[model samples]
Target chain A: MDQKTAGLNIAIFFCRQLDANQDKNRRAIEKELGLRIRFFPLPCSGRIELLHLLRAIEAGADVVYLVACPEGACRYREGNLRAKRRIMFAQKLIEEIGLEGARIEMVNKTAEMPADIGAIAMELLARDAKVSISPVRSNAVASFIEK
Target chain B: MITAERKPMAEIRAMLAPYRKILVVGCGSCVAECASGGEKEVGLLASALRMDAKIEGRTIEVREMTIDRQCVYEFIDQLTGIADRYEIILSLGCGAGVQAVAEVFPKMLVIPALNTTFIGETKEPGLWVENCRACGDCKLGYFAAVCPVTRCAKGLFNGPCGGSKNGVCEVDPDSPCAWQLIIERLENAGRSDLLEAIYPPADWSRQQGKGPKKIVREDQRSEG
Candidate 1:
């Protein structure tokens, strides 16, 4: 798949524990993006690791976004802050290794604003398309076609 | 726990280009504890790979799995059958886990998904600070358990280096002088006398170097 398809093939790891009507957020995402997002609920956003974001990229996610509560607004108090820092660290690593750092993202979204989820998803999709595919990936694609 | 960050989407996509099927292996140990990598990452990788590559009849299978510990043979061996199904193994563990996977499955290509840094602790929820060097020696007993090799900006063995200003290292103003911390910890524990014991230069051979190290158990030996 090209960068556009890659952007379309997005995956989100909703670290925050879902609310009583968590399906509403999930349903909105599916309807807007036409992407099946697999949710892995965490006790708190602090539990999500930076390696999870990296491995997701390795496994073939074009855009990996984290959904957390606003800063200091986390029910667990420190969960959102931890998630934000992880996203920052992940971006730094990505930039150092010559990849577009925008592929990994973090945003604060409450259950109240389900439409914001769609906006964030679209933003991520557009952002991922802007990233230039590495020569190694291009070569891999070329070789795969030959086989 | 070791601190690490995620590999970028473009970079990871490039690494897995040659293979159609890929295994995203997560370590539920250190990396998970540090928030550097884990099983939740597997699903993220699978989606990204599917998006970045588009080809006719090209099937990219993304599988997610986690091991209790990827540093040991027992844990690595547990992936026998599941590993064979994937053309490439993307390790979300530290450098040691990636090497262990590569050593066990020489036939398959192994790729690292995280950049492992030094041993650190969660100062708070998101903040991690380097705390140990794993220098293959026990100087901590002599230094009140505050590690100079890992925390000191210069890895100083002697007293606080002259570069220390107001208990902060010159190399990084934000970094605390390890010796200062050590001394305070020692003073509080009433073990200030241990500071008088000079530390000898560490032997490089004892620490990880040159090649792989191994140990044999004679206590558990049985007659053949």
Candidate 2:
């Protein structure tokens, strides 16, 4: 709340099905939170592979969250289930690498709850109030990003 | 199919401590089907190791490669020229795969990243239970398609032990008595006559021991 999460980038990979009006809903959250979010709209939650999550972190996403359709309601039968499995596996990988497993999260929601999605971003990106530029990024790149 | 489980992370880290460069090899056959030493697992493990190295402020390089079947020389041969890039190799294949790679690259150090557990069936996704012993001598015909060598706790062939209480093993109540399964299956098949026929001791020579085993078809051989 005290501008702790001001500079950290939170990447949200949402199933496009989660919000019927993907652009408007995504932009509303982006506008509400301003520059903090970089939304990745996936056709199905199954599209969120472990490599994608790890790559996001390697690219300096301060936090990565997978917002999938509710469990039994995946548009593609069981993409959400597949996404859940990969997310769990990814969490283990992140935990071993020296980051909190909480850095990657998997939560289910329907397409209409833009506020719910925003709430998760606010809660998580805010928890680590100490978001400085990531150690892997140079001050030049960091400052460049800030600009 | 040969089955295995990834070694605990702590043990993997200890073995990996000696190498700055590592190549994690995954098998795409049995281990893949069981969800242990597959392409997905290779990525998960390699990523974990890299992250651990980054956190310690140490440099560790990990590369991942998956072969169609790590036990075959043809597929394993693909790793030949490229494998030397790393100082050590972490094979996610079953025991056979680790040895296959070792046999090919005798000069390279190949380490097993999984504990070769048993030859089993994938009862379900993420669930594996021993179903076959591959005991050269096939006894499934006599046992009504059930394998006594793998199912029986003692590998008993003749009959159920007296310790079977209500069709559960005495050694482990949670385990169903393998003989009970055979007997019930026999009764259903109307082949209880085989139950009365005593099965002599199995030929242990064909099953295990005595160095490496080989099967050669003279027709398939290129030379004498």
Residues B117-143 of candidate 1 have per-residue lDDT tens digits of: 878889987688888777777678777
Best by TM-score: 2
Q: Which runs of model 2 end up more than 4 angstroms from their true locations?
A: A1-7, A28-36, A96-98, A110-147, B163-166, B170-174
Global lDDT of each model?
0.70, 0.80
Provide per-model DockQ scores. Answer: 0.09, 0.31
| lDDT at B98, model 1 | 93
Please give the TM-score of chain B in predicted model 1: 0.84
Say which candidate scores most in lDDT: 2
TM-score of each: 0.64, 0.84
Q: Write the per-residue lDDT of candidate 2 for residues B18-111, one digit (tens) a residue.
A: 8999999999999998888999889878867765665565677889999999999999998988999999999999999999999999988999
Which residue pairs clash in candidate 2?
Answer: A18-A111, A19-A111, A97-B51
Residue A23 in candidate 2 has what lDDT?
69
